[model samples]
Target chain A: MIKRRKFSEALFKALGLSALVLAVGTLVLLFGALLIDGVGRLDWQFLTSFPSRHASQAGILPAVVGSTLVMLVTAFVGIPIGVAAAIYLEEYARRTWLTELIEVTVTNLAGVPSIIFGLLALGLFVYMLGLGSSILTAGLTLALLILPVVIVTTREAIRAIPVQIREAAFALGATRWQTVADHVLPYSASGILTGIILALSRAIGETAPIVTVGALTFIAFLPPSPITDQPPYLSFEWLMSPFTVMPIQMFGWVSRPGEDFAANAAAAGLLLVGMTLAMNGLAIYVRYRMRKRVSW
Target chain B: MARPVDGPYIDSAGRGDWPKPLKAETCELSFYYGTRLVLKRVSVPIAECNITALIGPSGCGKSTFLRCFNRMHDLYPGTRYEGAIVLYPDSRNILDREVDPIEVRMRLAMVFQKPNPFPKSVYENVAYGLRVRGVKDRRAIDEKVEQALRSAALWEEVKDRLSALGTSLSGGQQQRLCIARALATDPELLLLDEPTSALDPIATASIEELLQDLKRRVTILIVTHNMQQAARISDWTAFMYLGELVEFGPTKRLFTTPAKKQTEDYITGRFG
Candidate 1:
């Protein structure tokens, strides 16, 4: 019996190691291929320039700018809504079927595919709301796609907070909102921030939803800045301006007949990977600092 | 640094101090966590300016009884309370359906066994109570924080590091900070649930000494597992067994010569 148990244990270890190798090995190979193809193509000029009919002249400036702006809008809309929903779920919501229903919905929504969210944006924001195929429409759609992720992370963060902190605050006569806004939220802020950054990174790489929302495959001009002035003025019309993000641009390139555009796609892919890694790094740092700050 | 505290202390000390002004009183109070009745009908008088210690073995509902004073159990739904917890001056039944737990908590502050300080500077931890009560002036907050810390006997240890995070302190210091936080608001009653169970011997002694000093200023109700601790600092001791009040009286007499057979057995190292 002992010999049989040993054999099973050895088999299990081999299976687990093979699975790990398969996953990591694939990621490394793909990243290695992108590095070789894209490194020579990357440059300040390539970063600064806009797309062109000639693949060599094509740069990802508009897509980069568009992605950055869209990500900002996503953060602006998603984080507040997500955090509020999370606070209600974890703090204020009584243990009732209604609260349970909301929780179940959020859990299910988190598992929905990104492309479905794109279709949702296409229908709701673009067509029904008459927002057109604009940066705002794409951003709003991406925000919807990521809201579940943000809310899940935020709820997890708030839930992980020791019950004693809440009890301490309430014991000192803080109202529920005061306890949450003053003590609970501040303590879990790093976790919330890390969640947001990770969610934004998810949105950053999303191509299907942005494309589904009708972002142009190629764009040569920057969307007008959301802040500009004739005098003491700011403009929001850029929110309605057409745009393309990095993944959409990259997808467009990789699908073309020519090898040059494929090379262009590889370079854009490298940049996208770099941005995602930077965001993940920041998230990890925030979590580390928060852990160091709070012993309990 | 002066702030208004509980009014007119009629000292509840000395055997013949007749009809002490009560801070709070519980009458036939029982508590339930769902359908399970954890605290049987318990009646006890909490005298102003004295420390009343609740002593019992684990799960005897001493903590639950202490939490009843401030309605701490309100955070969880389906946990119900029976009978009355009356605050003396207002004579309001704190368990009344219409009473706000928040307001009840303001009048009665609490500290837990484990020190839980917000992830802010020590100064912020003490000032939190005042800020919640709308004391916004920075100078006033600073003064009160200092006073409260001083009252808790932690000011000397933490004076130079007020800006340091509350969690940065030793476990004992953090517990003291929690006490200071409670004191900052000057609640009429302070509830401590095993405040020193997590502390080292020296830390426990310091807190016990502080508690002795604190009883002269504000009424305190404490839950302790240590019989000697109850004997040491508490003016009145109530012994509980199986969610029922076994006996209660002045601490010295209760420990030296308990009234009931159960109390005697429990205090004499017999099976709890």
Candidate 2:
């Protein structure tokens, strides 16, 4: 019996060690490939200049701006609504059949393919709403794609908070809004921010949805002012303008016949990777700081 | 200083006669979780400036009964209560269908078995209740937080590290910090549900001492399984069995000469 138990324990340790080695090995292999293939072409001109017809002249400036703009707008539009929905569902909503159904639907929505969301965005924002295939439309589509993830993550974070914290606030004569605003929000802030950053990262990498929604393949022009003059500066007509993002631009370059276009695509891929890494790194740092600040 | 009285005594009315008037009153109170009945009809008068200890074996609905005072049960799903709980002699029934629980909760605060402090600096955790009430002035918040911490008997230990996270405190200190957080809101009544059950003997002793000091300012209702704890801190005591109030009166009398045989059996450690 002792021999069997010892053998099983050794076997379990071996399996765990093998799993860890496999994960690390896969990560190293991928990073090695990225460095070998893409590192040589990475330079200042490649990052700061617009794409060119010539192989050597092409730069990723427009794509970088496009991705940044789309991501910023997506964060601005999606986070508040997603967090509010999560709070209402977790803290305030009555657990009737309707709420349960809504909860289930949200969970399922998080698992849906990003490409479908792009198609929906094309039909709704571009066609029906007449916004066209601009940065605004792409951002809106990406927001929809990531809204369920943000909501689910925020809900999980909120749920991680003990009921005792809320009870403590309520006992202190804090109103419902007050308790949530004061105790629940501050306590869950790190987790909620982490969820938002993660959602934004996911949105940043999404090419399928934006592609289906018709993000511009090449646009040399900067985005028009967010406000336009047809009616007044605050008019909704500003949203109809054309726009492009990095992923679509990279896809355009990669699919072309020219070797120069492929090189430019690799360079743009490197830039995109750098940007996403920076965002994720910032998120990790913020999470660490918050963990320290709220260390109970 | 007055000589403290001891031993159990009863008036001519058999047992369960209160020396003081009711500070809060519950009428025809019963609670249900989904289809399960947790509390039968229970009516009890809670006296002001005193500790009322609710004692029963596990699952006797003592904690559930305590939560009803501040409507903490409302946080749970499918929890329905049929009753009127009134604070003082006021006509406003706290359990009125139209009354907002948030407002009722502001007047009555609660502490739980486990200490739960917000994941914020110690200063911020105490200031949170005050801030929610719109006290934005930094100086005022500082003053109130200090006062609260002192009142909870924690200021001396935590004074230097007011900026520290609340969780960094030891278990006893964390419970005291929770008390400070509750006290910061200036609540009239405080509800504690097994607030010391998670603590070691030393921590428990400190909390018990703090409870004795706290009763002078805030009316306290504590639910405890410890008969000795109840005897130590409470001015009044209620013994419950199977969701029913078996007996309640002065703590000494309830412990020594319970009117009901069930209360006598439970208190004497004969049976629970």
Candidate 3:
């Protein structure tokens, strides 16, 4: 009997190890292929110049700029609203049927298809609101797509804080706001940041939602200068300008019947993966600092 | 043993000085968490500059009773407080809706069962109460932080490393740091809910010794499960059973000759 149990354990161990190896090995192969194909194409000029009909002359400048601006909008619009909703749900809201319903809905929302969010943005922000195929509409759509992820992560972070810590603060005569501001927010900051970055990274690679919201596959001109030489020295005109993000641009290149376009798509894919990894690295660094200070 | 009629049980048989002057007293304080009544109508007197320890078995509402003094129960919804926790000098009913819980907490401080120090520096942890109260002057905050740490008997070990994170300390040191945080505001009353329950024996001993020194200035009310700890540290003791105050008297009298049978049974380890 013992021999049989040992054999079973060994078999399970081997199965698990094989599974892990398969998954990691696939990722390594894909990344290695992208590196080999795209490395020669990457250059300063390729980054700085705009896209063209000629594949060799094409640069990801406009697409890169578009993605950055859209992400900025998503972070600005989604993060505060998501964080606030989470705080309200976790801290202030009483446990009732309505709150429970809301919780269930939010959890389910995170699992909803990204294309569904795109359709919603198409109907609401595009046609109904008359925002057209602009940067703002695409940003708002991505924001909606990631809202559930942000809220879920923020709530998880807030919930992880020990009740004793809150009691200690309250015992010191801190008001609810004071306690949240001084202890809760500062302590949960790393977890919230990790969640935010993860959500943003997820939004960055999204193509269908931005496409549904009316992002152009090809764009030559840049959005209006955000920093004009005017007295205010700031502008919001770019928000309303037509845009194309990295994923959409890559998709357009990949569909073309040419080896050069395929290489272009590979380069863009490499950049997208790099961006996501950089975000994840930032999250890890932040979480490390927070964990060192505020452990229970 | 003589039982005082219609008031808190005070067995002043062995001691000549019976009343030590009331810092605060609860008048039939009953607490309810939703529909379940946790703390029944229990009247208890906290003597000024004296350490009163509430001893009871687990789930007997001793911790719940401790939380009542600072209106800590008000933090949650559906938990209700009935009756009065009247503070001296002002004689204001802290349980009254008119009286703010935050205001009551400012007058009193609490140390929890587990040491809960903020992730901030030792200096900032000690200065937390002052910061909440809006004491912004750097010199004043520095002086108070030192004084509070010294009062908690943690200054010598942590004086040079004031900027170190509070959680970086040993378990006992963290508890003492919590005590320092509570003391920084110079509260009228200090509430401790099993402050040393999570510590080692040596750390527990140090904290008990510190409490003895502290009772000279601040009135303390502590809830402890260890009967020996109550006997060693507290001047007054209240034995609670099933959410009711069974006996309240001087520590010496209560430990040796408890007026009630329940107190005797629990004290002698007959049953909890």
Candidate 4:
């Protein structure tokens, strides 16, 4: 009976180990295929030039610039709003049904599909708000998509900070706002940062919402730069310009029927994956540093 | 000094001990955690610049009563405080609706059971109270930080590591850092809820000694499970049981002689 029990335990452990290996194997295969199809296509000119009808000449400069611009706005619009909402829900909100309702709604919102968010953005931001099919609209659309994730992560981080920390602050005669700003915010900053980056990572690869928001499929010129070619360089004109992000560009390429277009699309996929991994890596690194520094 | 009241003294103010000028006094204070009442009508006067200890068994509401002084009980919802905790010098009822808990806390600081140091530099942790109180002058904050750290007896050990994070210190050092953080605000009263419960014997002794010196500077009220520590450090000992103040008097008298049978039984370790 003991021999049978030991054999059953080992079999279950082996099965669990194989499941993990299978998941990693799938990821490795996907990366291998992307590398084989895309590596030969990567070059400085491909990075710098605008897209062309010929697949070899087609570059992703406009999409790259667009994604960068839209992401800047996404981070700018999302972080403060997400962090504030989290702080309100966690710290200030009363133990009432109203707070519970809002909390449950937010948790549910995180599970909503990207396409539904796209449709909502199409109605609210593009048409009703009259923002036009611009980078501003696309950024705002993606920002909405990631808000739930950001809020969830921020709330979790703030919650992870022990209650005694707040008690210590309050006992010092610090005001509620002071306690949050001083101890709560500073202590949970790394967690907040990790969440924001993860949100940004998710936002970076989103295609449907931006597409539904009416991003341009083919663009020859860059959006107006925030930094001017002259003095008094800062400008807001780029916000209203037409844009196409990296995922939408890859989607456009992959949908067309040709080997060359598919290969170029694969290359763009590689770049996009690289960008996402960089963001996730940074989040992990920040969390690791924070863990090393702060024990209690 | 007011003569030490003996044997379950419930109403000294009615007995005409009114003009003693207390630092603060809770008059028939009742506390509720949700629907369950945690503290019954507890009326205790805290003398200015003296150590008062509240002792009881686990869940006996000693900590709950201590939390009422600095409004620590107000941190969560479903917990209610009824009656008044009136502060002298200002003569304001802290439990009044208009009286801000923030302002009350500035005068009545608290040190918790576990040492919770903020994840910042030791200097920043100590300077935090003053900074939040709007003391922006760099020189003034630095001076106060040093003085507060010195007062907590942590200056010599942590002077070189002022820029180090508070969590990097030992548990005892961290508790002292919290005390310095409280002291940085220059509060009139310090409420300690089991400040040394997590420490080793030597660390506990140091903190108890620090309490004796600290009482000379600010009024202190501590809730402790260690009966001997209460006896050793506190001038006034208030023994509580089942949410009621069973007995209260001088520490020496309370420990040596029998006032209430429950207090005698608990102190003698017959039962908690």
Candidate 2, which segments miss by more than 4 Å at Cα? A1-31, A225-240, B1-16, B136-141
On DockQ, the leading prediction is 3
**Candidate 1 share of real interface contacts:** 0.85
Which residue pairs clash in candidate 1? none
In model 3, what lDDT does residue A264 have? 90
**Model 2, span A66-149: residue lDDT tens:** 788788779888999899999999888887999999999999999998998988888899889988887789878888988999
lDDT agreement with native, every candidate: 0.88, 0.82, 0.91, 0.88
Name the lDDT value of residue A95 in candidate 4.
71
Choose the strongest candidate by lDDT. Answer: 3
lDDT of 2 at A169: 71
RMSD to native for every prediction? 4.7, 4.9, 2.5, 2.8
User: Considering chain A alone, what is the TM-score of candidate 2?
Assistant: 0.90
Clashing pairs in 3: none
Q: Considering only N, C-alpha and C atoms within 3 Å, which residue pairs clash in candidate 4? A: none
Per-residue CA lDDT of candidate 1, range A1-296, in tens? 99999999999999999999999999999999999999889999889999998989999999999998888788889889989989988998888899899889998999999999988888999889999998888878888988999999999989888899999998888899999999789888888999999999999999888888888987889988767668546877788889999988898899898888888999999999999999999999999987888767
Which candidate, 3 or 4, has the higher lDDT? 3
- TM-scores of the models, in the given order? 0.93, 0.88, 0.96, 0.94
Model 3 C-alpha lDDT per residue in residues B51-104, reported as the tens digit of each score: 999998999999999999999889899999988888987888899999999999
What TM-score against the true chain A does chain A of each candidate get?
0.96, 0.90, 0.98, 0.96
